[model samples]
Target chain A: ANDDCSKMLLNRCSGCIAVRKSLNSRNISKLLHSCPHRCDHHKIIVEAEDKYKSEVRKSFICNKKILLTPRRRQLRIES
Target chain B: MFRGQRGWFCGSVGQDLRQLWVAEGGTVCDVQAADFLFSCDASHPDTLRIYQSLDYIEDNATVFHAYYLYAVANAEMKTSVALGHFILPPASVQKEIRRKVGGFIWEQDKYFQIEKHDEL
Candidate 1:
């Protein structure tokens, strides 16, 4: 029943346990009510770093996709 | 050794992986000069190519984790294991990583599963 997850290594707490079990047993709307930690998890997963936060615009994510794509290189000559 | 161990984070779990490493007292560094590599999967040959370009060997890189972002979190996809050497993180650090890097949720049953490398 400790709520201090900051120090705890594993999320083996009862809250985390209930959330894991709910994933396969409920709907999003109902799940939201059943667990608030869902929001917390989302925050951790999608959270961005401060350094790049300012660069994240609506089109920034699109740019990320492009950057992630495989790139091909070719030799160039400037004679 | 752990204090300043530099590491690189690649694949879908880049941000999360970087955060986890930093939280664990290890330095999450850029790929250009990294002592360790954390890749989500090995599906992309480019990942391995990058490692090679960095002059790093297989023993220095580990690709054992995959993440699935659900609609609830605004991601439109789920991921599966790819062909490669998949090594789980050290058992000692498993609990810490899981606790901090909360994972995807299954709407059908409404349980939150902390994303970890579930396969060998």
Candidate 2:
């Protein structure tokens, strides 16, 4: 339960685990919440990146059907 | 690869060939309906994807762009694997998806077609 040990544990975990694994953030927060550490900055950055990526992912989601019925191609004749 | 319970019909668990629902899960590895889906396992990494004329999204300038746009956007939500090869971003593969969704078949093949489950 030393300060350095707490920091080491936080370093090994990913921010996504907070929700995916349902781990409480209280302890990790105290160790990292607004603390002047690079992991704190990294967590913020990674979280923001995922949010943006999810948005773009929605933009391409297949909600509409794109069934293409083929048409014979006509050769173009120019004078 | 875990699948959530789907009432007692779609398939049976165990050695039986169970179908996967490509939309419900984020990854394609565990979904049903393998016919409508295909992905390269770690070995054959050089596979390709397509968008059939039957499944092509139309250009924007057309009067039907609004309708056509609505269609592709409304298609079923399959795992990214089903699309990364077909509807993928060009940086991953320099070709346009529409031109290649169904190969160059002029109308004989079943071709690629994405539709809403409601339509089925």
- The candidate scoring highest on lDDT is 1
Task: Please give the TM-score of chain B in predicted model 2.
Answer: 0.16
List ranges where model 1 is wrong by over 4 Å.
A1-79, B51-120
For candidate 2, the per-residue lDDT at B66 reads: 13
> Candidate 2 at residue A59, lDDT?
44
How many Å off is the CA of A12 in candidate 1?
Answer: 28
Q: What lDDT does model 2 reach?
A: 0.24
Clashes of 2: 25
Chain A of candidate 2 compared with the true chain A, TM-score: 0.31
Candidate 2 ranges beyond 4 A from true positions: A1-42, A61-79, B1-120
For residue A41, model 2's alpha carbon misses the true position, in angstroms, by 5.3
Which digits, one per residue and each the tens of the lDDT, describe model 2 over residues A1-79? 2443334334533431232211111122222233343443234433332343344334445544422234333222321
Enumerate the candidates' DockQ scores in order. Answer: 0.03, 0.02
Give me the TM-scores of chain B across the candidates: 0.43, 0.16
